[model samples]
Target: MNVFYEEDGGFKVGAVLADNTTSLQVEAPHGKRSKIKAGTVLLKFEKPALSEFMEQAQHVADELDADFLWECSNQDEFGFADLGLEYFGHAPSTVEAAGLLIKLHGSPMHFYKKGKGHYKAAPEESLKAALASVERKRLQALQQAEYTAQLTGFSCPEALLPQINMLLYRPDKNTIEYKALEQACHDTGLTPPKLLEKCGAIPSSHDYHFNAFLFEHFPKGIEFGEIGEFDIPQDLPESNVSAFSIDDATTTEIDDAFSLIHLPNGNWQVGIHIAAPALGFGPGSRLDEIALERLSTVYMPGNKITMLPDALVNAYTLEATKSCPALSMYLEIESADYSVVSSVTRIERVKIAANLRHDTLEPLFNEDTLARGGPDYPFKKELGILWELANRLEIGRGKQGSNIGTDYSFVVKDDRIAITDRKRGNPIDKVVSELMIYVNSRWAKMLSEKGVAGVFRSQFNGKVRLSTTPGKHIGLGVDQYAWASSPLRRSMDLLNQRQLIALVRGEPAPYASNSEVLLGAVSDFELASEAYNSFQRNMERYWCLRYVLQEGINEASATVLKENLIRLDTLPLVTRVPSMPELPPGTQVQVALSNVELLDLAFGCEFKHRIELQ
Candidate 1:
C-alpha cells in the first residue's frame, strides 16, 4: 500500500498518476459553497477496528491510509475477518464476496493475535442478543400504550362514550328517562358518585341521578311542607272548560275550580271553589303523617308518587259531583280594580260540575282553531263570557304589574322532549287561577283582621334581602296578603281552613296571641317545598345532559333571568350538545361533540370540538 498524494493539505501532499486509485479529487463545504481540489489525501483499502464496528466506522475510515470502501449488505453486522482480499486499486469481486460473508455471519467481530490477545464473546451471538433485547423493550412499550387507552372507568368513562349517545330520553317536566340507570350499577362496579364522575365525561343516566344527589346532599338549608287534598269544583265555579276528563273516577277529584259573573252594579264577580281537606286529614292521620314526611310529589314522566294518597286526596273528603262536606272561606272580587273586596267563612256544602287540566283545554282555545272546529268543542256561547271576563282580569292584572312571568311548556313524544312557548293564557285556566287567588287573598286578609292563626302562601320578592315580600300581593298587584286554598294539597291551607271553621262558628281563634309562631312554620313549609321542586328540576337537567348533549353539535341561545344560572334553549331540536361557554352569548361556533354530563344525566351522541366561528 502507498501513501496518497494530497493538494488540500495534511497527510500525503502531492498529485499521483491517474492510474493510482489512492489519489482522487474531492469537494468540501467551505462557508456556503463547495470547491474542488485534486489529490485529496485519498486512501487505499483499510480494515475497520473492533471499536469502530460498535460505534463510528466512518471515523476509522477517515484516519486510514487506503481508500476505505464502506460496503454494507441488508444485514447490519460486519466483522474485521471480512477484509480477506488484498487491495490493489480495484477489487470489486473479492471485496463483495468478503462483505457477503460478513453479512452472513450476522455479528460484529474483534480480532487480535492468537497468543497475545484477549477473550470475548462471538460477535454474531452477542450482537444478536443485544438487538433482540432492544426490540423486546420496544414491543412492551407499544402494548402498554394500547392497554392504557382501553382502560375507561378510573376517572372518566372514555370507553362508554360511544354507547351513551343513543339511549337517553326525557319523559316529563324536569325529568330524565334512562331505562338503563339501574343496570349500570352492576357492570360499572361503582357507587352512584363514582359512576357519575366517570360518566360525566360522556352520556349516561348516572349523570342526572348523581348531580341531583350532590345538590340535595349539600343544600344551603332545608324547608318542609305538610300535604293536603282539596276539591277543585266545590270551592269555585265551573268555567265550562272541558279540559281533561273531570268526570273520570281515576283523576276527577275536585281540588280547584272557578266562575265569573256579572253583578247588578255593573261590576264583575270572580269566584273560586276549593275543597277542604284539612277537615279530614287532621294532624296525625296516616296520610297526614306521610304527607308531612314526603312534603312534595316526585313527578317523573312515566311515574308520579304523590305526597298524599288517593284515600285522602282523591276519595274521602273530596268535594266531587255535587257533594261537599265543610266549607271554609268565600272570596268576592270587585271588577273596579280586580280586587278582593269581600270575604266570608262558614261551614257549607258546595256543588260541583267538571274538572279540567291545561293540556286538555288548551286545544279548544288554540290560536289556530276556534268555534269552527267540531261539535264536541267546549268553546260555546256562555263560555265566551268566561273568556271575556278572564281577559279583562288578566289585562287589569298586567297593568298593575302582577308577577305573571312568561311561562314555557313541553310535551314529551317519541322519547324526546318537545318544548313550546306559545301557551298564551288559557281563559279557563286564568279564570280559575285568578278566582282562587282572590279567594285565598280574601281568606288571608280575614284571618289577619280577625287576629287568628293560619297558614300563608308566600314567594320571596326579587330584592336584596331575598325575603318573602313583607305583606305585598306583588303577584296580583295588591296590598299585603297571603294564600289559603287547596287545603288537601297544602298544610297551610288546611290550618287556614280549620281556623276559618272556628272563626265562622264564633269560636275563639287558635293561637290568637302567638300566631306569629304558626306563621313562621307555614312559611318554612312553603319554602321547603319550593326548594325541593327546584332541586328535582335541576336533577332532571343533569340526566338530559348525559343523554342528549354528550356527542352532538349544540346551537342555542340563553338568558339569565335569575342570578344563579343561565337557561339555554337547546333541548327541543338538538341532542348531545356541547357546553355553552365555547359558543358564548350572541356568538355561534361550530362544534364536534361526543357527550354531555351536567348535574347527573348523561346525553349526546359525541363530544363537541369547536370547528369555526360564526
Candidate 2:
C-alpha cells in the first residue's frame, strides 16, 4: 500500500489524500501495478506495529469509516507530498494539497468517526446517536413552547423561548424548585399550592434550576438582576431579634458582633453577638445534613455559599437587639498589660447598638466625628478602653509565648484587588479582637482541662509532616492553643460551644462523642484552609501577572525563593525581606510573567515564570 510517513514516522494510507493531494497518496502493492485514480479505496492501519501493522492501521481507519486508497505513493521526502488530485472539482497545487493533508493528519485525527483512521477513533453510529439526542431535545422543547404559547396565548417566539429553556434545563431537584415556585407564585399572583400539588410533592430544587423554570413562564417579566439579590421576607413573624440593615451589600449573617459599653467596673463590657445557627439548622433538613457534611462556611474569592439561609442567619437567630439571648464573657483586665484580674462568663441577653467593621470605622477615627456624637459616646469610650486592653493583652500573650500569625491586608481599588502593607491596625479593632481571643482561648482551655469532648483548632509549629506530638502553635506563639470561639463557623466550634455551655450549666460532659470524628473534622478543616489558600494564591498570581503586564517594571530585584518560585519586589510597600534561593542569594533578574502550566508536583496552579539574568 502507498504510505505517507508522518514527522513522527507514522504511516497513513489513502488513494487521494483528504487534502486532495495525488503526490501524498497511499496505494497498496497490488494497486501499484493497476492505474489508481482519485477516490480509490484502500485498506487502513489494522494490525499492531508488531504484526501486519499496516493492515492493523487500515482496520482502525475502516473502524472510523474512512475511504482509504491502496499503494498510492507520495514523491515527497517525508512521503507526505501530494500528486495532482482533484478535490471537489478544484485541483489545487500538489504541495498545497500535501500541506492540507498534513494539517488534517496532525490535528486530532482520533476525533473523526471510527473506521476512518487509527487516530480517527469512536464509532460513527455513536456520534449520530448523540446528534439525534440533541435534535430530539430541541424538538421536545419546541413542542413544549408551542403548548405553553397556546395556554398563555403568547404568539412571540421571544416570549416563548424562556419557557422552553426552563422546561428543558430545570434540575431534577425539588426543594429548590419549591422555593422558586413559591417566589413565582407570590410575584405573578399564581396558585403556587395547586401548581405544586400538580407536580409531585418535591421538597427542594437548586436555585439556578428553579430560576430557569421561572424564566420560561415569564421571560420578559423576569428581572435577571433581581434574581441575584436573594432577600428573605422581613414581614415574617418576629422572633426575639429581627434582621435590620440599611443595605444588602453590608449585611451578612456572621457568628459574632461586638458592642461596647462603658462600665463603672473600669473595663469595657464588650458584647460578642453570634448568630445561633445550630438552633435553626439542627438535625432534620437536607440543608442541615449538608452543613454537617461540609462543617463550615468557606469563602472563596469568586464564590461564597453560606452554611445557613439568610432567614435564620441574618434574621431570627442572630444577636441584633438588647433582648437577644447571648453568652457574655466579661473581663475586667488592666489596659496596660491586658491582664484579666477578674472575669465573668454569663449566659444572658445583650444588645449590639452598633455593628461596625474596620473599614467603616477607620475613616471615622481619622475624622474624630464618632466621639463627638452623644449617642456614639459610649461606643467611642468602649473603643478606647478596648484598644488599651487589646494592646496590653497582645503584649501579654507575646510574653506568654503566643505566636501571632502574619497579617496580610489588602484593599479593593478601582475594581482590582490590590495588596496593601499599610499599617492600618487601629486600637479599637485590636481591643475587640484581643478580647474575643482571650475569652475563646480561656474557654478552649477550660473544656480541654475538664476532659470534655470538643474540637481543637490549632496551627502546627512550622512542621511539614503530621506527627503524634505537634510542636508549639507558632502563629499563636503558644506552646499549645485551641479555639472554641465561633460556633456558627462549623460543628467543630459548635461541639466546643456545647461543651462550654454544659460546663457553665453545671452539667456532665457528653464523652460519647468520638475523638476520631473530631480528628476527622480537624483534617477537613486543614483541607478547607488549604483550598482557601490555593484560591487566594491563584488570584494573587493573576493580579501579579496583570501588574507585570501593566504597571510592573521589566527589571525588578528578584530572589529565587524556591526551585520554581522567584519572589520579585514589585511594590515598595512590601516590608518582608527577600527569600534565599539555592543559587547565589540575591541574584538580579529581568523577569517577565510567562504562562506556565502547573504540574502535579507543583499543585494545580499556574506558575509565573522568572527569567534570571546571567
Candidate 3:
C-alpha cells in the first residue's frame, strides 16, 4: 500500500514495506526507507503508485477552491475526508481527500489546523483581517521592488526625498525605504552616501560633510533660543590705565589685554586685564545655560559657533575705544629686573586703548626688530618689557630652548581659502601666553589656598586631564593651572571666572570644595571639547585638500615623520604615501598629487624624489 503522511510540516508519499501495529517500515518515492509512526499516516491506497500519488493530489488541490472548501466545512472541527465527501457528494477517492487536506493546510487564514488531517474554519472577522494583512504585505513587496529598480537605474524615488538624511546618517533597517536602499546599494556596489550622490540626491560635498556633523552633534540645529534680559552693573570702579589687546584681525571677542603704569615709587605696575563676562551672568542664568550647552566655541577653518550670543560678546568684549569691565591682575615689579614685587586681582572698568592685529604688528615688532633695537610702534615699550618678563617666566618654568612648530591660520571666503603661517613660540605669542599662564597659575594657587574648588588642568606622561582638586601640572611646570581667562569663549573658564570673582569679593564661592558639580563639568567639557577639536581638525584637513585642488599645484614638499606617514609643508595635511622609501624623520621629499576626493576627503599621492635631510 502507498501511504501519504506529514513529515516536518510537508506532505510526502511512501510505500509501506512492513506494517507493525504501531509503526511501519516504509520506502519513500525516491527509494529511501524510514521507520515512521502509523499515527502520522493520513491515507493508504492500493491503486496509485507512490510517485504519482503526490503529483495527482497536488493537481487536484490546485483545481479546488480553498475558500469554497472552508465555507463548505462544518462550524466545529471535521476531518478532511468528511469535508471532501460533503464537497464531492459521495465517498471521495484518495486524490480528492488528499487534495482537500493540502488545500486546507495551505490556506491558514481560511482554515486553522486542529490536528493531523483535521482543521477548523476560521471566524469571519479573523479571516478578513488576515486576508487584508497578507494583501498589504504583497503590495509593500511590489513597491519595494519598484523602488529598488528605480535606485539601481540612477533614479531616486520621491518617497526617499524627505528621509535621505536619516537614511544616510541614522537608518532604521526595519522600514521598507531603508531595505530598498540597502538592496540598491548592494546592487550598485557603492555606499549609501556615494550611491545617493550618484542618483543626484546629495549634490554638494560640503553640505554632505557639514550635515553629517550637524546630524550627530546639533540634531535640533545650531540656533540660539530666547534669552532673558540681563543687567550689567554701571557702578563698577573706573581705572586710570588704557589697556590694549593683541589678537588676530578676525577677533571680535577680545578676552585679554595689557596696560602699563609707571609707579612713582620706581617700580612698574603691569595690568593683565581679562574681559569679565562672568560679572553680567552667574551660574544657572540664561547666558550661563547657553554657554553650558555649547561648552566652548567650536572653531573650524573659517567658521565658529560661539558659546555666548554676539550681543553678549559685544557687551563684554574689550574692544578699543570702549572702557569695558575687566578682571585685572596687577603685578608691581622692579623696573630693573622685572621681578614680581606684589600681585593683586581686582574687578574694574578699564579703557581699551587699541586692538593690535598680528598681520601689522608682526612686521614692525618681532624678534629681529627687538634684537636690533631699531624701530618702534604702538605699545612698543610695553611689548618689549612684557617680552623680557615672558623670557624670565619661560626660564622659570624650566621649558627654556623649546622650539614649537608653526601654527597655520585658515581664512575661507566664498569658495576661496587663504592659509597663513605663524610661528608658535614667537615673542608676541610668548608675551601673551606667559602672562595668561601667570594669571591662571596665580588664580589656581589663590583658589587652592582659600579652600575653594576649581577646575584644574594637569598633565603627566603626555596625558592631559581635568580635576576638581589641585594637582601639579608638569607640562606647565606650575603648582596648578586653572583656566580663568576667555570667559566669552569657554564655559569652564567662565565658571572659574565666577569662582574667582566671588573669592575677590569675599563672598561665597560658586563651586564648593570637592563639588561634584565642578568635577562633572570638567568631565563633560573634556568629552565635548575632544569631539569639537576632532571636528575642527577634520574640517581643517578637508579645507587643506580643497586648497590643494583649487590652487592647481601638483608638486608639493613633505617632511617624513616616521616611515611612510609625512606632513606636507604647504598645508597642515598629514597623510600616508605607500611609495615612500624608508627615511629618517625630518627628511624632505617631493610628492605629486593625483586623485583628490572631496566627498571622502581622501588624497592619493605618489612620492617623486627626495629633497634633503633637515
Best-matching candidate per lDDT: 3
What are the lDDT scores of the predictions, listed in order?
0.44, 0.44, 0.89
Give lDDT tens digits, candidate 1, residues 23-72.
Answer: 34322212222222333333332333222221232333333332122222
Candidate 1 lDDT for residue 189 = 65
Give the top-scoring candidate (TM-score).
Answer: 3
Could you give me the TM-score of model 2 versus the true structure?
Answer: 0.49
Better of 2 and 3 by lDDT: 3
- In model 3, residue pairs whose N, Cα or C atoms come closer than 3 Å (at least 3 residues apart or on different chains), thus clashing, are none
Report the error of model 2 at residue 11, Å: 24
Please provide TM-scores, in order, for all candidate models, with all chains considered together.
Answer: 0.51, 0.49, 0.94
Model 2: worst 10 consecutive residues (lDDT sum): 597-606
lDDT of 3 by residue, 316-338 (tens): 99999999999999999788988
**How far is each candidate from the true structure, as Cα RMSD in Å?**
18.6, 17.9, 2.2
C-alpha RMSD in Å of predicted model 3 compared with the true structure: 2.2
Worst 10 residues of 1 by lDDT: 110-119
Between 2 and 3, whose TM-score is larger?
Answer: 3
TM-score, cand. 1: 0.51
